[model samples]
Target: MSSAAYERIRNNPKFDKLVATRSRFAWTLSAVVLILYYGFMAVVAFNPTLLASPLGEGRIATIGWPIAALMMLLFWVMTGLYVHRANGKFDEINAELIKEATKEAQ
Candidate 1:
């Protein structure tokens, strides 16, 4: 594509909205993952015994095991959500913006 096409897309308000929306969403997801990871670390640092304890009266597993597993699962779910949005809403807006830019350039 020509620079003119790129310039038209950049000047479009929808382009701005798409960038803002996508950045906000990505940042939000990043923050959630950071919090989860750091919070777990904090607990492990300040209270080792809590996480080190057994899962139940007779179980060999520790409480931290399931928590760590769930955290990983949640991270995967968050990733999937981002991919879904990027492929669905973000891609749709991007395609529309490109189409508009191409038309204007012609």
Candidate 2:
């Protein structure tokens, strides 16, 4: 693409909003996942027994088992959410940006 095309997109307000919204959303998700993962790790580091200890008197499962499962589920959910939003809102803004840029180029 030409510099003019690039400039047109760069100057578009919707382009700025798209970048801002996508970046903020991505960073927020990253922060949440990091905090959850590291919070679990920190707990393990400080309290090893809490993770290893059985859930109850007769149960075979440990607390860590469910937590690990939840973490995996959280990762999947977050991924799905990001994909859904990107396919919807992000794509819409992107298409608008392209449409506007093409109009300007012509």
Candidate 1 TM-score to native: 0.91
Clash count for candidate 2 is 0
- Candidate 1, run of 10 with poorest lDDT: 97-106
Q: On residues 1-106, what C-alpha lDDT tens digit does candidate 2 reach at each position?
A: 7888889999999999999999999999999999999989998899888898899998888989988998999899999999999999899999989899989778
Q: lDDT of candidate 2? A: 0.92
Candidate 1 per-residue lDDT, tens place, 12-82, comes to 99999999999999999999999989999999999988998999998889999999999999999999999
Highest TM-score scorer: 2
For model 1, the stretches where C-alpha displacement exceeds 4 angstroms are none
What's the residue-level lDDT of 89 in candidate 1? 96
